[model samples]
Target: MINAINLNSKLEIQAEAFIRFYYEETKKSAQQYKERLSEVAAEIRETGTYTHTKQELTFGAKVAWRNSAKCIGRLFWDSLEVFDERSAKTEEEIAAALLRHIEHATNGGRIRPTLTAFAPQKPEGSDIRIWNHQLIRYAGYRTPDGVVGDPASVELTEAIQRLGWTGQGTKYDVLPLVVQIGSRKPKWFPIPGEAVMEVKFEHPDIEELAGLGLQWYAVPILSDMALNVGGVRYTAAPFNGWYMGTEIGARNLADADRYDELPAIADLLDLDRSTNTTLWKDRALLELNSAVIHSFKTNGVSIVDHHTAAEQFMRFMKREQEQGRDVNARWSWLIPPMSPAATPVWHRNDLTEREIDPDYAPQERPY
Candidate 1:
């Protein structure tokens, strides 16, 4: 069909563009670039796709992080460890690779930025898919009282339950890893306890905050994104950077739709919650975020607070400017949920989110 021909042609064009970009960034010889481009052209002509060389894959993976407009951690983009799992086609193989990713990235408790590139989808889109939004996440159980765990996970948790997974029915019960190859049925594997590193919530100044029983999994590995390098789509590529404090505090825990801990936290702290002007939510958020940062540091985990992370993002923009690259960013994402005006990014007027190639795109859930 003409559609197939057009798809192949687009892939060829994207392939050449990425190769040129790669060579430019790496300062490899023009002859080598041309040779690689020619080989890719031939491969696409015959098979409708071309495989990325290990070097190309590595560079491309890093570039994808750099091109991620929503991420604030691009300053450390080059430090990402890429684990190539393109040959992993079975459920056990993929699950094993993901678990290994967890252990390696957890790094005893100091999390490392990592990405595990899985099998790339064909031109028409058939390859591996990870059903979980994150490799290690809390489950949700709906009851007459309410959702007992992460409310964000209610849908996935129900689907996972349908797949015969039973959690321990706790607020912090880590979910299993679910992976699917092609259109085959997905399989769930309980995440090994040894690979999971968790930081229990504790306050540096407020000792009573510990009794709330909040905890978070270390190393937030996003497993549902498709990493697009040139035209090849690694449908199940899971990647992670260490968490920023407000992400867990101001948003994940404090959000009313999420854990909604502010009310209880406010009550515990004895803040006046009778009216919005009392600023009870603001007070609670500050303590929650402080507790998160303090606890993570106490447990030897890598976590960045919003202020430093915002400054670092600006530095990243400056570095890109020095390299004659236009910086693209999303204003909403760059501004931390806790204190927007306190960060440099929130005051910026020119933040625009323009997406580029070799990026990680959010894919629809295969479940």
Candidate 2:
């Protein structure tokens, strides 16, 4: 019923409408997330234990905005199919439109710049003194494979190139960057076509740097090492416990008897059960379930069959519960806390060891 010209016209209109809707929604969502992040930053600042500047708060807000933007962008991409199916545009064209929309949505948003200090002047043969609480050092190298061994190898090099680094003159080139004394050694180097930069700092120093006015590109610190004291921390989930259902076992047995005829549903249920831990909240559980289902369907399994398998698994769980068996059982254990040993030295005074009380229980020591 539709000619090529008419279809093309419809495609253009749909593309425009999608982009407009996406841009507005993403911007609105980003702003909302940013405001919430600012509130958190303000709370941290009020504690006074950690000195956080306005710049640090702003940076945190920007990070929240970026994350929200990314989530919105993904949503837009997923919804593109509705537009694609209704219009006559090719898949590639639809994707391109979505990409452009994302670009427009993210452009000119709040950004934090990389902060570098001037090289501290040290007396000859004396170690350099770093004043700030944190110090970041950027090192350059040339490798054979043109790739760094670290996970950010490709991205680091691309960012460096974007910053206008070209390997023209020297066998080893140094960018206009500064290094701090007593920083940790880097584990990898960038290859010939690539370049690497290492950022080193403690939390206070990072907060200070984020506040400084600079026009450099700084990536949000997302590593676990960046989040914890000495990179050691523990997390707890409260809702972890046994789940019981009466219909579960019978349904499981029935499904097993017709295994080949019904398609292997055990694997699907096992995967779903394995993932439904209290460690993740309700929203995360739903998202993970959706992802698992999508993966199975993509691998040539029918959605209807997947749904049937899920229902059967639920019934099986119910039967197990009726038989006084746990459908799900979750437990938690404490991860050992981290502490550094005090510096050992010669003692001047003779000290006596204290005696333990007879009624006192022996406490277990953590390594």
TM-scores for all predictions: 0.97, 0.17
Candidate 1 lDDT tens digits, 1-367: 0011122488898998888888878888888877778889889999889999988898999989998988888999999999998888789999999999999999988888899988898866668889999999999899999999999999999999999999999898889999887878889999978778998999999999899998898889999998999988889889999999999999889899999999999999999999999999999999999999999999889999999999999999999999998776788788888878988888886778776888989888787
RMSD to the true structure for each prediction, in A, is 3.5, 29.7
Clash pairs, model 1 backbone: none
Model 2 lDDT-worst window of ten: 234-243
Question: Model 2, range 1-367, lDDT digits (tens) per residue?
Answer: 1111111233233322322333343454645444443443444345412222233322322222222211111111111111111121232332233223222322232211221111111222221211211111122343674322222223343344554554433322322221112233212222222222212211221233222111111112111111111111111000000101101111211223211111222232233334546322233223223332333233332222223433433454356467563322111100001110111111202212232110011111110
Those runs of model 2 whose alpha carbons end farther than 4 Å from true positions after fitting are: 1-7, 19-151, 154-200, 203-367
Q: What's the lDDT of the predicted structure labeled candidate 2?
A: 0.24
lDDT of each: 0.89, 0.24
